[model samples]
Target: MADIEPYENALDAIPGAHPYPRTSRYHDAEIGIHRQADGTEVRYAKRRLLPPIEDRTGDDTQSHTVRTGERPDLLGRRYFGDPGQWWQIADANPVLDPRELTDEPGREIDVPLAGHFPRSPQGDRRG
Candidate 1:
């Protein structure tokens, strides 16, 4: 028998982990998932509408910090060219306060990419 390593977040295990940003236009969303006849699980992909990117890095921008006010929809539009793509950003950063738009300034945090794909309801990965 072979020992298997426990699964962990790639970014969590490594310091300063920065994955390449993905294009929201190129993301395939799962509409549904099911087990195949061979006992293999498969996901059904659907073309989804992504949100827009809203860069709040202005004079009020905090240093090395991610603000809760940074709307994913806004970001989707700025980065992926659509406001509907906000879910992708939300899915990437679940710790963020979706309701609150602004966070404490000067807090270190992760900035989700256009297609980062968060597991939140907005992302809707159940499909």
Candidate 2:
């Protein structure tokens, strides 16, 4: 899969969630598996929900003007020192799709304060 590292990182950061199939379209989704009447297994997946916009707003929040060729992971690395934390920026914005959120140039996005997110484990922060 193309650009799967961000998804893997996000999934790793979520606590106590079921492990999703890496090859599934729902690889980035939160999922539950269930057994059907005879012996069939079904997987139900939902896009992970974000916290309310109000919850992400704060005095320390900062804004970034989208520049050409910028992406969430790139922005995360630039601002937070960890590219894997892209979801933090995605969750703070209003768009349901993070790709759309970062696709345009000149768009403005709110960046949550660094303290609002969990710090990366000492060894995990890497380019």
Candidate 3:
């Protein structure tokens, strides 16, 4: 057995530490442990499923032209009022790399209105 950290997230069922960055895209992701043959416990955050492009974008979405020297953190603050929520901007765009959205000036990017995803980590859109 290896050293293990403890946790008390009300949403989590397993006994392990939750991921850092409470506002991160992986905030609600479950903690997984891989037991090696040597009994070493490798803990990792499970994969986070991105919401559908359509769900994240709609007629209400805002289109902003990227300016030179602009960054996602700043954009997040401008839009969501929290720099850590930058992932919301990334989710609204189609670019695999969020940095690319700001790399070139004059590129229009989609800014979803008030984050389009649900409160759950599973992206439960059944409602």
Candidate 4:
């Protein structure tokens, strides 16, 4: 298993992005390192490409309509009882960018059923 040192570094370099799940395959991915003319090094992780939403199973019971000013994390907390599981809602929906999933009011989003998320090594919940 790969450690999260590099991923943590990459998260520190990015703004407005949360840390990758500890059990996620991308958690161990190599971040690009570039050296500036002044000899400063910058570390960054490549944009993570999510699998197609078609790959996810549909559950009519978990479907939700985008309300005004709602976000994925809020929905995750409402449906799954965990705000950190926002990615499950993001992944189950067609939008690649989570922000787009809730960007417009009245848009419908598909939320994955409970237990649809990957489990951490310690059996903790993750997104």
Candidate 5:
């Protein structure tokens, strides 16, 4: 005779199962960040005003060109002191492309004010 054990049906029936595999606070400078269920967007909090970027363009080769449009990763290394943190800078500026960070002669994107860039519904800062 062979011994057999009963089979478990639901996932909850299994022992040692944790509910949340990951936890996040979602702390963004922008307040309008929230989740969408069906087709409508719901605001979680009031939008926070971001500091405007100071126009620091000097009398050089380029004029009327946006400076915030520069590569984010490089700016991250320079500003945040972390190259990996580039996405943070990029997220704050949706007009710029992430891949273009390494592109020579980077494209001119509208410089975001020093203030926090609006986060997308998907949580990605990319335009």
Candidate 6:
């Protein structure tokens, strides 16, 4: 705690740091900061919000039965054609970690239509 710096300077100081990829679940989330009473600033990415599973029904989503050795990235590749978009499947189901989606064989998981980024029905992003 010898030095106190502005929040923006944190990430800016990192040389050649790459931003999150488009396929990342965090692609749309903006950086955020929290200021402490003592003047320290903590920077972080805002939480990426996902709607409840019930809202994803119909044309926007379908179902897939998880198989042995199946993984979210592989599922993303097969369905969305981009292995990095696995977060889409994570959001569609009720799991904090995408790995849980494929934890059991024969488990049914939600698969959104390709490129169907789930936004609130009202078309707003609160995150």
Pick the TM-score winner. 3
Which stretches in model 6 have alpha-carbon errors above 4 Å? 1-19, 35-42, 120-127
Cα lDDT tens digits, model 4, 1-127, are: 2433576556656764644544343553445789999999988865555545554555433667899989877887888677776876776666758888889999877776665543323333223
lDDT measured at residue 87 in model 3 versus the true structure, 0 to 100: 83
Tens-place lDDT per residue, model 1, 1-127, is: 0222233234335653322212333333434678989999876544454333232323322223445566546655765576765544443343445433325544453445422323322463213
Order of the predicted models by lDDT, top scorer first = 6, 3, 2, 4, 1, 5
lDDT of 5 by residue, 62-118 (tens): 221325545555665665465655555444333356765435453443323332334
Computed on alpha carbons, the lDDT of every model, listed in order, comes to 0.43, 0.65, 0.71, 0.63, 0.40, 0.72
Off by over 4 Å in 1: 1-64, 67-69, 113-127
How many clashes in each candidate?
Answer: 29, 0, 0, 0, 4, 0
Q: Write down the TM-score of every candidate.
A: 0.31, 0.55, 0.71, 0.50, 0.29, 0.67
Provide the lowest-lDDT 10-residue window in model 3.
Answer: 1-10
Ordered list by TM-score, greatest first: 3, 6, 2, 4, 1, 5
Whichever of 1 and 3 has more TM-score, that candidate is 3
Q: What would the TM-score be for candidate 4 when compared with the true structure?
A: 0.50
Higher lDDT: candidate 5 or 6? 6
Best by lDDT: 6
Q: Write the number of the candidate with greater TM-score, choosing between 4 and 5.
A: 4
- Compare candidates 3 and 4 on TM-score and give the better one: 3
Clashing pairs in 5: 50-115, 51-115, 52-114, 53-114
- Misplaced by over 4 Å in model 5 are 1-72, 92-97, 122-127
